[model samples]
Target chain A: MSYMISKATSVNKALDEAVPLCEPVLKIREAMRYTLLSGGKRVRPMLCLAACELVGGQDSTAMPAACAVEMIHASSLIQDDLPCMDDDSFRRGKPTNHKVFGEDIAVLTADALIALAVKKLVTSTYFGVSPERVLRAVLEMAKAVGTEGLVAGQAADLAGEPMSLEEDKAGLEHLEFIHIHKTAALLEAAAVIGAIIGGGSDEEIERLRRYARCIGLVFQVVDDVLDVTKSSEELGKTAGKDLIAGKLTNPRVMGVEKRGNIFKGLIQTRWFR
Target chain B: MSYMISKATSVNKALDEAVPLCEPVLKIREAMRYTLLSGGKRVRPMLCLAACELVGGQDSTAMPAACAVEMIHASSLIQDDLPCMDDDSFRRGKPTNHKVFGEDIAVLTADALIALAVKKLVTSTYFGVSPERVLRAVLEMAKAVGTEGLVAGQAADLAGEPMSLEEDKAGLEHLEFIHIHKTAALLEAAAVIGAIIGGGSDEEIERLRRYARCIGLVFQVVDDVLDVTKSSEELGKTAGKDLIAGKLTNPRVMGVEKRGNIFKGLIQTRWFR
Candidate 1:
């Protein structure tokens, strides 16, 4: 826990410096910084750094990639909360990005952050990571953000559309597809990219990818359960709003009690074993 | 003209292959293709390929970079035409992206195209472009897309805000600032990245960068002038809409005749010489 706190602190500091309020586009930068610096658990970046260190890399080597994932995560959050998407009013206990900055600026803010993330990862060659590894990591980041990843998941979720299934079935399979692409994909990329940057063997990188995948799905399942169990204030976001919007969730599909059982079962099988 | 036609043909083919209508994200891909395939002049990609060849690199070596630039340009156009932005009803003789695929899908389409551009550039290491050059190219692309480039230009243009000027002056200087960032920056990046991929020396790359910058600004000035002079049918887009929206443009800042003179002077000094 102490290790996590220290890493989170470093990440927060790094992010703050990444985009300072400078001349000639201060508004866009402000919107970006506001969304990025808003408090979160820093889970994805921590996952990146941990994977890097577990593979014998220095913390400094993966810091940029760590920050990149966080920026991408922040970008996704802003996009998800837009009026055209989830239409959420609050996030992390504050007004959503579009609510604070107008919709146009909010959109541009998200786009800029994604570009910044790519820039940071690719330019980290100064940090002693090889260009080959940096290229691979960037490719992974792009995959996680694009059609095969978050966009597909969000689109499927919004339209409740079937994806690559033989039948247009709406079941656990569909739910898993949405969660895997939308939530787990970036987390998987985070760990995989860290391991790659650390010069881990292919086998090691694959192991970390699987580990992150399990953790990501578990995180989403728990989030779905909490949406029903917690208050809006408790969650620091609009709780039960997913249900109001008729969005699918673990609790909605299988009662909250069963979802808890599934969470524990996942831990027992994927982690303990 | 034949060289231009051949290069644009190759770019179009490469782009079609880059984003096939694959399963599990058909809708997103449709939106992306709908915007991307709509005919544009393909000027940026041509500049990229031409720069690479001039630097002694094969056209095949820079084709991916060329496609990537086009994708980035298409993404910006989609965002620019959104209702919250310019609110244009038509682009490239068809309904704008948001008009055809709803605002939500249009937004996601733009985001996906950006990601796809990065992915295409990095993964093109298979083209035998060295990792060092690819990394450099990716960094350049990011800079052109982020706050210092397209985003900054769009934000300033939308808000009519002065950028880095002493007295918030709004004239040719402000217009120049907007055009340089919004248009010239990406074109400069395209040429620079092409030169890098072609293994050009620093001097060669810098020279091409300046050359592309001049061309980009000229392109925008001519576009602004045409917006006033051409009919909607002639332009294949909404004509005279800039004046209708009271958007600041080269013709609006200086009369159309002076803008034309500037264009001729630019060609004479930058190209013909």
Candidate 2:
């Protein structure tokens, strides 16, 4: 299997382990699988695992952080696919979480998934890391998901949802902030958090931050490219949805040449394992 | 000032002390204050203060958790008010976060605020409780916010966003979960977290939980009644909005006789300080 597939499968396994027992509610089980098992690439969770293993740790210890990162990512997607957020019909070659599950269950499922991830962090880290470190991680992750990070980006993204050319076209900074925060912050958190849990030094952690930043930008560029280059049949997510949504993407920023240059420069630096 | 007011003010003061040196992004700050200072009843944070005091502790150490509860609460509100979610145009007599800050900034601001609150929990708890306890507090708060708690409720709520009478009809059970998880769970966390920070015994913590549950339910009940009796001109939040939104409420559940009974029973209880 390709590294991505293996990593994604293991991350899915790790996520299964990390997900708390759903309250045996029909709604929860249905909604959760709708989003989780819909088969998107588990890129964020893989980042956590790769970072953990890079520093000589395993998913056994890093699983909670991994799950937390993915949960935040997944929750964002569930919301993103909502008729209000992204409103795209398909994700990972399947109907979006809200579309399949209905909106009420969709929102609740995302909320529950986020809760499960955080709870796991508390439980797993309790015996593994120093209380202070664990506390720090929880706080850090929370902040990562907070208003300034993904949520803020999401709000901004949603604000720009309708996509009038006159407005969003000029708001490139706004769109970048949204992308960086909404999508990349959680990805970065997975890596940084994995390093933290794996006992990487502060300097190592800083390097990992740079690593995550590099990959985050690269990952997003790849996404922008994929969204444009791929067909809806080629990419699970709707092709060119960003353009349709009027998202201020790098491609949208500098067009084909400039965006390609940035993507190439960053991707060559080896963010991927 | 009422006890709630004094407690809220004090927590606000400590929040100033405990928060990181905010460089102050204008959009972010505007979004934060637009809701935080918008004259909330502060019942949740007040529960934290009362719990801290009740456990013979001071507000100095409980500040972060107090602020965190409020931040968490605020983030949820922003999410809850999304066009795909509750779809409310106004909350507390003001335009909802998305309506005012515009969706993008409002969402980002709510997110940033939540992250800041987590940061507070990490740093703030050092003054009183152990780091482990602070982590524990954060874990609890996360659980409340996510699926099993508020987020799940929200998902269910959103699922019902385009409700038909044939569906759950905002059933009493569903609404109970919504209100409890969305409101009471956090309130309970604020209470227990304050006590834990104060070094309360397990017995005291249990007592606080019971107290929290009672007051939380009472608070929700009062809110339900207020939706009927109070005018939006005075209450800020529009009256009958719950029904308009198809919420499963106490009035809808218990009818007049049972509603009055529940309220009376709560008022006579010793849960309130």
- Which candidate has the top score in lDDT? 1
Worst 10 residues of 2 chain B by lDDT: B160-169
lDDT (tens digit, per residue) of candidate 1 on B1-273: 897898889999999998898656888999999999999988888899999999999999999999999999999999999998999999889999999899999999999999999988886588888999899999999999999899988998887632332332456667777888899999999999999988899999989988889988888988898999999999888999887777778767767767657776677764423
> TM-score: which candidate is best?
1
TM-score of each: 0.95, 0.85
Candidate 2 local lDDT, B1-273, one digit each (tens):
676667877766755554334643456666776777666767777788778888898877777778878877877887777765667787888888988876546545655665676677777656857876777677777767765566665555454443444444446557666666666777788888888877788899888987787777777887887887778877776678776766667766665457878667666755544
DockQ of each: 0.88, 0.50
* i-RMSD of model 2 (Å, 1 decimal): 3.2
Off by over 4 Å in 2: A1-6, A17-25, A152-179, A258-260, A263-273, B1-4, B14-25, B103-110, B126-128, B153-179, B243-246, B263-273
Q: How much DockQ does model 2 earn?
A: 0.50
CAPRI class of candidate 2: medium
Q: For model 1 chain A, give the 10-residue run with minimal summed lDDT.
A: A160-169
Cα RMSDs, all models: 3.1, 4.5
What lDDT score belongs to each candidate, Candidate 1 first? 0.88, 0.71
